[model samples]
Target: MSSHVYVAFDLGAESGRAVAGIYDGQKLELKTLHRFPNTPLRLPDALTWNVLRQYAEILQGIALAV
Candidate 1:
C-alpha cells in the first residue's frame, strides 16, 4: 500500500497553525506541525497584525514539514 501526505495552514484572528495529514488509502491522520499567536500591535490610533513574525512562523512550519 501507498500513502499520501498533505499540508494545511489554518489562520485565524488570534492564532495560526500548520497541520499535516497522512492518508493510507482508507483513513486520514492529522498532526499539528507548528502553531503561533497572531498578535496585533496596539498603536495610538490603530492595530495591525505582526506580518513579519507571521511570515517567519510560516517558514518555520515549512521547515518542520521538510
Candidate 2:
C-alpha cells in the first residue's frame, strides 16, 4: 500500500503556496498547486494577514488538488 500527501497551504511572511507530494519509493515527487503573494501589511504599528484572501486562495488550491 502507498499514500499520497497534498499540502493545501503554506503562508509565509512574504509568500505562500500549495504543494503536493507523491510518496511511492525512495524518491518523492512534488507538485505545486498554487503560488501567490502573501505579504503582511503593517499599519499603525500593527501587522496582519489578509485572512479573507488567504482563505479564498486555500479553497482554490483545495479545488485544484481535488
Candidate 3:
C-alpha cells in the first residue's frame, strides 16, 4: 500500500490554519499543523492582512506535515 500527504490552508474571518491530509488506498485523515490569529495590520491610511506572516506560517506547517 502507498500513502500521500497533502497540505491545505484555511483562512477564516477570525483565524488561519494549516491542515494536512493523509490518504492511503481507502480513507483520508486530516490534521491541523499550525494556526494563527487573523488579526489585520492597522496602517496609517488603511487596514491590511499580514500576508508574509501567513506565508511563513504556511511553510512551518508544511515542515510539520513532512
**The CA-based lDDT of model 2 is what?**
0.81
Compose the digit string of candidate 3's lDDT tens values, residues 18-56: 999999979999988899888887899998988887788
State the TM-score for model 3.
0.90
| Residue 54 displacement in candidate 1 (angstroms) | 1.0
Q: lDDT tens digits, residues 1-66, model 1?
A: 898878888888999999989899999999999999999888899998888888899889888987
| Clash count of each predicted structure | 0, 0, 0
- Per-candidate TM-scores read 0.81, 0.72, 0.90
lDDT, candidate 1, at 45: 90
Pairs that collide, model 1:
none
Where model 3 places Cα greater than 4 Å from the true spot, the runs are: none
lDDT of 2 by residue, 1-66 (tens): 576775657898888899888677566888998998886666798989888888888888888787
- The candidate with the higher lDDT, 1 or 2, is 1
What ranking emerges by lDDT with the best candidate at the front? Answer: 1, 3, 2
Task: For model 1, state the Cα shift of residue 36 in Å.
Answer: 1.0
Cα error, candidate 2, residue 54 (Å): 0.7
